[model samples]
Structure formats: C-alpha cells, structure tokens
Target: MSGGDARQISVRTKDRNSEERSEQLAPPLRRDQSDSITYRSFLRVRAYAVMTKPRVMELLLVTTVPTMILAHGGPPNLPLIVATLMGGAASSGSASAFNMYLDRDMDAQMRRTSGRPLVTGEVAPRSGLLFAWILAVSSTVWFWCLVNYLAAALSVCAILWYVVVYTILLKRRTEQNIVWGGIAGCFPVVIGWASATGTVSWPAVILFLVIFFWTPAHYWPLSVKYGEDYRRVGVPMLGAIHGIEHVAKRVIAYAVATATASLLLIPVAGMSWTYATVAVVGGAWFVGEGLRLQAAARRAEAAARPMRMFVVSNAYLALLFAAVAIDTLVKHRFS
Candidate 1:
C-alpha cells in the first residue's frame, strides 16, 4: 500500500476503536427500560401530589379569593391575588404533607387512608418528612418575598398550627379535635383579608367564624360515612364515638351557626342583594340537609345518606363565596 493509504487506514482503525470504547463505557438504554423509568417517575410525582391532599386544599382556597374581594371592596391587585393564592397553596400542601408523615402509622390501619403515600410505602417516611420541611420553609419564604410580612407570618402560623396543634396534639386526643383544629383551615380567609388590607378586620373575623362553624357541618357527615374506618384506627372522631343521632344534632347546630355567621357578613361587609340571597337561600338549604340527616338518624335507617349533607355543604360554601365575589364585582362595575 502507498504511505498515504496506510496512514488513512491507521486513523480509521483508531476512530473505530474510540467509538467502540465509548459504547462500552456508556451502553445505550433499551426502550423498555426507558419506559419503565418514565412510568416510575410519573408514579412518584403522583404519590407526592396525593400526599398533599389536593381536595382539601381546593376547599381552603374556595374561601380565600372572595375574602380578598370583600376586603379590597372590589377586584384587588391581580399580582397580589396570584401571589397570595400560590403562597396559600404551598403552605397548605406543606402542612398536609407533614400530617401525612406523622399519621402514617394510623393511616396504615385505616381503610380510608391506607392508600396514602407513606402508608403504602410509595414514599419513604424520612423522605416525606424532608419534603414537608422543605415545602414549609420554601412556602414561608415565598410569602415573605412575593406577598407581604403579614401574609408570611400568617402562613407560618398556619403551618405550625396544622402540623403541631392539629395533627400532633389534637387529632387523636379529643372528639372536639376537629372543632378547634379547624382553626387552621379558617386561616385562609384571614390571610386573604390580610393580603388585601395588610391587616385583619371585623369582616375577616366574621368570615373566619363562618368557616369555623361550617367545618363541623362539612366534616361530620364524612366522618359518619367513614366512622368505622376511624374507629378501626382508634381515632376519637365524633362520628366514630357518638351515636348517629347525636352526631346529626351537632351537625345541625353547626350548620345553623354557619348560616348565621354568613348572614353577619352582609352587614359587616355591606354585601349586596346577590350575597344576601345566596346566604339566605343557601344557608336555609344547608341547614335543611342537616335536619334531614337528623331525621334519618332518628329513623335509624341503614342508608341514612349522610353523604348527601356532605355534598350539599361543599356546594353551599363554594356558592356563597362565589356570590361574595360576584356581588363585589357588580358593585365595582356600577359604582
């Protein structure tokens, strides 16, 4: 061979060798293996999302924006609304994650909670704990930086109250646990008001009490449906310990209080007819459902359908808040 041809052959050999070595160092992944990895990652993400109890967060957020509108007396700053909502979501998610971690043991025993990430071993307890702390710290900082000091402080307090006071101290201790522990859930409206006004007011207090009274009315029926699950886990939920008739009476009382507190908003915030009609009509419907549950309890019917009241309570709160927002916008547009 000519000298040039031999050199070319040598370089070609070297290039082939280099390519072979690179393949050996990092073998190409099989398609199936790549698919398996992607599926696992998706499941991990879903598990994390479930740990946050997003359904509960949705209910908390339902009260927030309307309170902001009432406190602003109209549509507030768009950026401020977005920031407060994001911060509130993060704070709520952090608290829920912490609760899941702490209650994993109880969760494992309860059918309602058996599928939880920590209980099902979808997320390791230690990793879940770390995730909770990271979210708590990051969300508090997000509030401080993006929202305001009052919002930030309230967010921190909410996390502490939910994780420390509710989950750790109260949940397993008393039937009244939800009554007092529900205070954490009430914070969203107050935080919304604070975010809008930089302080809490009588209207905010009224809304806070509305949520407080509405909570038992909202939760007790679900507890009734799942009372056995709670009893199996040795949790002291009222529905698990008390007679259906007794639980129904309490639900009616709280429903009445919720309706009353909602009406107080009309005078305190000077809400218009739109809000007044919703509060009056929706409140009556809400209390009526409670009474219906009580009647079912009196009959000792096997299918008392307590869940009907639960469903109605959710719709009531959402519609009432929607009325609040709509009323404010109507007033703003005309005035």
Candidate 2:
C-alpha cells in the first residue's frame, strides 16, 4: 500500500515539474508579438521623448555649460555641473512635451505640424501630458536638491513661461507672441548664472535682454515665409496679421535692435576686447543682412533671400556666443 502511494506521488511531482519548465520557456514578452509588454513600453517612452523637443534641449544645455565655465572663473563644480544639466534638460523637456499636448489641435491644423507624433496619433495625448508632468515634477525636485532654490525657481518660471504664457496665451493671441514669449529661452542663462552665484545678477539680466531682442528678428523671417500656413491655422503671426511686407520692415527693425544689443553685451559681460571686435563685425554684418532681407521681402520675388537671412541670423547667435566664450578664455590666459 505504501509503495503504490509513493509511486503515484513521484509521477505527479514529475508532471508538475515539466509543466513549470514549459511555462518558463514561454517568455513573458514574446519577440514575435507586437503587443508584447516590452515593445509597447518602449514605444510609449520613445513617443514621449519625441514630444519633449530634443533640439531645444540641445541648445539650452549648450548655454548652461558655457555659463558654468564662465561662472566658476575656471573649472566648475563637477556635481553642480551634472545636477544643473539634468535639471535644465528635464525642465526644458517637460515644457516641450506639455507644449505638444496643449498645441495638439493647432498642430493638427497646420501642415508643417500635422505630422507631429501627437497630432498624427503616434502618441496618445494623455500619455504625452503624463510624461510631461512626471518629468517636470522630477526635474524641479532634482534641481532643488542639487542646486539652490533660485535655480530651481528659475527653471519652473521657464516652464510656465513657455507652456502657459507663450504657447497657450501668446501664440494664438498676437503676432508679438514671440516678443514676449522668447523669455523661455532666456531662462537658461539666468538659471546658469544663478547656479554659480545662487542669485540673479546684472550680467545675467543683460544676457536675457540680448536674447530677448534677438528673438523677434530670429523668428519673423521664418514667420514671413510660413505666413500662409500660420494664417490658415488662425495664428496671429506678425507676417499674417500685419502682412509680409510690413512684417519684413519689423524684422529689420528687430534686427537693428538685436545688433545694437549684441554690441552692448560685450561691455556688460565684463568680457575682453576680442568680444568687442566680434560685436562690431558681427553686429554690423547682422544689420546689413537684415536690410537685405527687408528689401527682398518688399520685392515679393524669390522668398529664398529672406530664408537666407533667417539662417544667417541663427548662425550669428551661435557664433557670437562661441566667440565671446573663446575670447574670454584667451584673454584670461594671456592677461
């Protein structure tokens, strides 16, 4: 009786083990299954990243590093550097994603924007907003812990300025949208400056002003070319509302202001003579290009000329900052 019972129990145990092994061989997320847990999770993450505006983050982070180098008077605090970068990235990224969420309807209307991941249904709007919220909260906490309160506060201001004020309010309301909204991009400089000193300074304010003045001209040329799209979408862009020719005049005016501001920044930055030279050459050239674009817009011929002006304006900003950085380093070493 005992032997018979023991044999039956042994067979049952072996069967159970075989079933367990078979289950193990069947992966939780099958490679061939498109609906597998891993694949869906990855797509969700990728879509979220796309919404966060990587290009904007690239430029913003670039600004932070230079500010750090200049602020420390040489080698920066390594931990502060990493923390500041993470905070800046997360804050900017969150704002960008939120913008996608807010502008989903407008994006669907414009041909240029209709193909965005959110508008195209590549990413669900809810998921995009959730991602933005998570990132923004986490980033604020991160900066608060790593940097001082001033830096964290500045980051929050940047997010609010871009998402709420610029994207929601200004973008639809007035052509002067970029004029007031450009403050979003200007925050990184202030945040970077504050990260070093933990307080806003006149130099940082000057940097803010320079970027602010540069923004309208920077944007208007593109707006002029895309005025039709903007009009179709019911966006009150300068070019669309005021007319391209008139907007072109404003573009030149902004460029004139920006060039003047660029020259002014050399002294305000407490920088050397080399920076002064870049300002003189860069500013003059910048103004000349603006005038050319203004005339081109008036002629109503090849719009390509105005487009070139836009490209040159971008080059001017990037190079101007780089020159300032290099010149400061050089002069410091020699002096």
Candidate 3:
C-alpha cells in the first residue's frame, strides 16, 4: 500500500498536468502562425503596390527613355538608360506619393483623386510618406552613384520643387502656380539629357521648353473641365481664376507656342524629315484641337471632348521624340 501506490499516483498526476499544458498551447501556436502569415502577406502586397506609386513611376521612366535615345544618337547607353529610368522612377514615385499625401485634403475633395489608397484608408498616411521618403532617398543615391552628380542633383531639385515649391508654396497661392510648377516636370528631360551628355546644352533646354510650353496646353483644358472642383478647393487654376473661355484661348496660344518651339528642334536637335513631318502633322492637329476647344467653349463637356487632347498630346510627344531619336541614330550610325 505504501511506496508503489505513491509512485503510481505521482506519475499519473505528472502525465495529466503535461497533457493539459500541451492542449492549452496547441491552438495558440496554430493561431500565432496563421496571424503571422496573414500580416506578412499583407505587408508584402503593400510593398509591391507601394501606395499606388507604380503608375507615376512608369510615366517617369517613360519620360527618360527618349532622352537616352537622343543622347547617344541611337541607343548606345542601354545600361545607363536602365539605371536612369529606375532611379527616375523611384524619385518621381516618391514625389508623386508625397504629393498625394500633401494634397490628401484637396484630393479628398476632388472626385478624380479621392480614391487613392491613403484617402480611402486602405493604407496609412505615415506608411505612404515613409515609402515616398525611401524612394526619394534611394533614387537620389542611385542617380548619384550610377548616373552622375549633375543628374542626381537635378533629380533632387525636381523632387524638392514638386514637394516644396509647387505643392506647398505655389499651388494654393496663385493662379500662375501651374505655370511655375510646370517647371518641376519640365526639368526631367534636362536631367536625363545631362545624365547622358554630362552637360546641359541647347538641345536639352529645347526639350525642356517643349515640355514647359506643352504643360499649359496640357493642363489648362483639363482645368476647364474641373474648374468647379478646383474652385471648391480654392486651387486657382486657369479655368478656376479666369473664365473657361479665357482658359481655352490660352490653351490654343500655348499649343501654337509649343508647335513653334517644336519646329526649332528640326535644326537644333538635328532631327530629320521624319521628325519634321510628325511635328507638322501632330502639331497642326494639336493646334486644331486647341482651336476647337476655344470655339467649343459655348458647348457642353461632351462637345469639347475632341479638344481634351491629353492622351493625343502624350502620343504626339512620344512618337515625335522617338522619330527624332531614330533619325538622329540613323544619321550617326551611317556617319
């Protein structure tokens, strides 16, 4: 009754305690693993999406490729082009995300921009800004190391101008904000050209002008379409400040100016008949759109759709530059 009974009872007690502890721990371990997996997966997807930055990054990347082509005359710098595009993508992506953050208030007001992940609360403001900062800093360093000092510095300037000057200072201040802020976007081509040539030249300046003049032509029409929204937000766009009819005339004026500047490139940028033909045809058509916009001012939104030429303008520049680059390359290759 003594020793054997005590030993058997103690063993049973220890075994039961161990079984209880194991049962208690099992669900929690499984739950912990499941939660960890879910959180990690959400983070991973967010990282890839990077707060809806891929769109702006892609456009920035596209903006540089033509400069690379024209720089070497025919695609001599594939690696450099790739690096510059990536760096620019990062830099512009950061700027764009930061812009969304800064303009979150305005963005919330505008139906066009209200659906952003940050505004929609799918992602947090802090997280978006942090992603932007990473892209901006990383792209700056990348451009500095891979491209050149001037290119890196200019890239930084673009971001600073966009964030500080255009977004913070100019946007809410004056109706001419778009005009000045347009400078921020116009400089990317200059930076791209300098990254290749290692110096700013007349050609780069001309490309800059092309974008500069085209900026008003591009944005003013759209502004007319959204004048009411901008007025509600206190953003003094051309259409918001001046009458829509005035905005339309300015769009025409800017289009003509852009076309005239584009023609100068036939000699300066060393473009050929191919480029000239595109300039004439596309430019004439673009100008015609502006005129239509000016005339269609009396009509409603549907009537002016023909004059809303952003997509066409984009294609025009892309193809026009491409043709010039190809022609320049052919000439260089043959020579």
Residue-wise C-alpha lDDT for candidate 2, range 1-335, written one tens digit per residue: 69999999999999999999999987685367567888888876777778878878866765677666666555467888888988999999999999999989888888777878898787888878888999999989998888989998999999999999999889999878999998898999889888988888776777677778888888887787777789988998786677556766787787778777767666666777777787778878788887776676677745636677778878887777776667766756776
Give the per-residue lDDT digits (tens) of candidate 3, residues 44-149: 5675375546754544555567776777677756788888887887777878878888998888888777777777776678888888899889999999899999
Pairs of residues at least 3 apart in sequence or in different chains that clash in candidate 1: none
For every model shown, the clashing-pair count is 0, 0, 0
lDDT of each: 0.91, 0.80, 0.79
Give all TM-scores, in the order shown: 0.89, 0.84, 0.82
Which candidate order results from sorting by TM-score in descending order?
Answer: 1, 2, 3
**lDDT score, candidate 3:** 0.79
Per residue, candidate 1 scores C-alpha lDDT tens digits across 85-171 of 988888999999999999998889888899999988989999999989888998899988887899899999999989999999999
Error of 1 at 100 (Å): 0.4
Residue 197, candidate 2: how far off, in angstroms? Answer: 1.5
When summed lDDT is taken over every stretch of 10 residues in candidate 1, the lowest stretch is 27-36
User: Between the candidate structures 1 and 3, which one is better when assessed by TM-score?
Assistant: 1
Models, CA RMSD each: 8.9, 9.8, 8.7
